[model samples]
Target: MKIGVLTIGAELLNGARIDTNSNWISKTVIDHGGMVEFNISTKDNQSSIIKALDFLLDQSIDMIIMTGGLGPTHDDITAKTLFEYFDDIPILDEKYWNFLVSRFKKKGFKVSALNKTLALKPSNGKIIDNPIGTARGLHFSSNKKEIIALPGVPSEMKSMMREATLPMIKKISQKSIHSSILRTTGITESSLYEKLFSLIKQAPDVELAFLPSLFGVDLRTSSTDNDKFSNFLMQVKILLDEFIYSDKNLELEEVVVNLLNNHNLTVATAESCTGGLIGDRITNTSGASKVFKGGIIAYSNEIKINQLGVKKETIQKFGAVSIETASEMAAGVQKLFSTDIGISSTGIAGPLGGNKDKPVGLVYIAISINGVTTVYKNNFKSNRKNNKRITSQVALNLVRKELLKF
Candidate 1:
């Protein structure tokens, strides 16, 4: 089934907020074996909503999924506009209103008249359940086109989509679609394309999408032809095994933590330019406490010398952003924490503090494991934020690769 998405918010167009709903809806539709034909973002006004509705209805889409403006405020006009467009009158649902009253009462709050509006829906519309919020979604079938109106808040929309929208779409969709995403780091989009060009040409039925960001590239492969997809993916994996970190859409940090757990190892971090970002990423995963010993933010030479035990002579000789200092920091943290592995990152993440010999974005990442410390150097070309993020990613990737050796 083909679907069209309508995201209603003036804040999205004015750049005050991003339209994450549209992207989430599109991906969800695709994952559920339905295709998104187009997406239209409109202002939070009656005229814009009517125009957008008219345009989408004129298209050859099977259904429309809309989000935003379903609240108890003046700007929340989606429900009213939709009822008017369908030539329906608002009717109160007494059972839902009672539930709302009990819910508010349990929370020690009084239900205002404005909250009652949430229980009013179009006379002909079917109510879509929203377990997380007061704004209940509505489903209207008019002139053979199905419209599913949902609350704009991301959490509410996602809950409704999974609980109600996906089931509805499944009843109409006839095709079976499957997708797998392979996440890779230390490789550029162009390089991946060049390497996979022949494999891509060999499999014409599979759909391949290259999604790149500051961290890495995600290769999402989807197909309706299951046999052809399996064969093609097996070949791609064999060719790109070294660069591929995960085939289940897991983040690099998650991958590292999983590897550490699988091998029954522990790790600690000593961060410099990246601050505590590396440790933060590692701890973001669940069960990280089992494998993550601890971290030290050695931002200054004194801290590196006193806390992480980096020799002052090494810092004085080769500066802080050097392989020597990074190696010492990694070894020092490993010995201090008494972990199986220790990682460190020292760099000049800067829009400043650069020279001819030691330029901005110059970084040295080290990993100490089994009494051996290995260091890698990179000269990235990005602003401070990006440099810091990329350095952390690279450091995590190093940890991931090292864990694979065991």
Candidate 2:
């Protein structure tokens, strides 16, 4: 099945709001064995919407998934424009209008006249139910081409797509695009490509994609051939097992938490440059309390010395962002919280407060397990926010690697 996406909103074109709807629709379509032939965004005007629809039809796509401009407001002109494009008439859905009135009345509010627009549907179309919102999704088919119109609201669109749109596409989709995402950390995209290039060439049926972000690189291996897909995933595991944190798309923090749970151990954190971000990621996962004891934000030298028990002499000799201080902080947190594993991060995450010896984005991460402390030094080149975020990711990856040993 070949699909085209149309997102209609003035805010989308003017950069007031992002067109996340198109991206989500494309991904969902691709995941369910459909190909998104094109994605076009247009202003919330009848002329622009008509032009976009004409272009999508010209592409000869099997279906068009349109989002945005589906509401009670005057600018919400998708339904009216679509009816004109298809040369159809609006038919009021009396049953749905009564239901809406009853629903609003039960909530102690009267249904406004503007809301009646939601119950108006094209004469030649079928209504796609929206359980969460007042506006109903519309599906129109003519001359072997179909259009599925959904609300602009992300939550409402997602609910309708999952409940109705995807299942409808699945019935007619003859080709399945089999794909899997392999999550990895502590490796760069270029380096990972170099490692997997040979094997990738050997398997001509599989397509490998490198998606690199601030945290890590995600390896998306896809193949229409189901047999080849399984084999390619196995090859990736054998080659990049050390760097691969989760083959199931789980986050590094989730992986660390799972490992700690399996080993029946608890962990703690002592943070400086990254503040309490490391602890925040760990606790974001469900059941984190079982493995995460607590954390301390030792941002200042005074807090490091007083709260985490970092020796003042170590800070004086090696500086606060040095390996010695990081190691001491990790060990101090482990002892302070009586956890089996303790992690610490201390660095200069800044555009300022850096000098010749210690520049910006210079970070030191440490982990203490069973009284053995090991430190890692990393230099990242990015802004303050990214430096802090990447440092937190690195800290989590370090814990993941250590937990794997147990």
By lDDT, the best candidate is: 1
Question: What lDDT tens digits, residue by residue, belong to model 1 across residues 1-406?
Answer: 8899999999999999999999888777777788899899999999999999999999998899999999989899999999999988999889989999999999999999887789997778888989899899999997688999999999999999999999878888888777788999999999999999999998989999999999999998888998988988898899899999999889999999999999999999999999999999999999799999999999999999999999999999999989999999999999999999999999889989989998998999999997899999999974999999999999999898888989
lDDT of every predicted structure (CA atoms): 0.92, 0.90
TM-score of each model, in listed order: 0.98, 0.96
lDDT over C-alpha atoms for residue 212 of model 2: 93
lDDT of 2 by residue, 1-406 (tens): 9999999899998889988898788767767877788999999999999998888888877899999888999999998888888888988889989999999999999899998899897787888899899988889986687899999999999999999989878888888889888998888999998999899889998888898998989988887899999988998999999999898889888888989999999999999999899999999998799999999999999999999999999999999999999999999999999999999999999888788899988999999999999999999874888998999998888888787777
List clash counts for every candidate, in order: 0, 0
Per-residue error (Å), model 1, residue 162 = 0.7
TM-score of 2: 0.96
Backbone clash pairs for candidate 1 read none
Which consecutive 10 residues in model 2 have the weakest lDDT in total?
Answer: 26-35
